[model samples]
Target: GESVGLHLPTLSVQEGDNSIINCAYSNSASDYFIWYKQESGKGPQFIIDIRSNMDKRQGQRVTVLLNKTVKHLSLQIAATQPGDSAVYFCAEITSNTGKLIFGQGTTLQVKP
Candidate 1:
């Protein structure tokens, strides 16, 4: 199936730094994109989203870049913080299903 999965178990970084989380998708027909942030024991919160027609989208503290050419995507966080320390997921949506196909998750570790 063309769902998301995680490549590594964890990623460790220091506070006040920038973090880049990567996601590898499975389906090439996906059109819309979204990024989510999940705490230790909670559901994912919407972070940012982009469409296949666009290459990039930005939020207050986060940015999402999509590379349809390779079926890959990435998320960039401006400053690493304890609050920013969580699991991240990338989702793809198309005209069909109206459901999102997620990518392999990446865990952001903030070392204070």
Candidate 2:
């Protein structure tokens, strides 16, 4: 069998600085992508999303970039704060199933 996916499990950043989280998806047929933030003891919250038809999308202080060519996606946060410390996950919805498949999450630790 061959490996189909991968992720970074942790990321650290200083408070008031910026953070960028990356994800690589294997399913090229996926047409939608999303970034989620989850705090301790809480469920994941949606941060931003981008469709395969688009390359980038922005929301509030967050930005999501998608590169279909390499099946790469990234989330960018500006002026990250303590409240921004959480586990971030990237999910993709495949055209075949229309169900979201989540990648291994990356924990964002904002050092105060």
TM for candidate 2 is: 0.93
Model 1: colliding residue pairs: 4-102, 4-103, 4-104, 5-103, 5-104
Looking at model 2, which ten-residue stretch has the lowest summed lDDT? 1-10
Model 1 C-alpha RMSD vs. true structure (Å) is 1.4
After superposition, candidate 2 runs with Cα above 4 Å error:
1-6
Can you list the residue pairs that collide in candidate 2?
A: none
Query: Model 2 over residues 60-92: C-alpha lDDT tens digits?
Result: 999999989998999999999999999998988
Question: What are the lDDT scores of the predictions, listed in order?
Answer: 0.84, 0.87
Error of 2 at 109 (Å): 0.3
lDDT of 2: 0.87
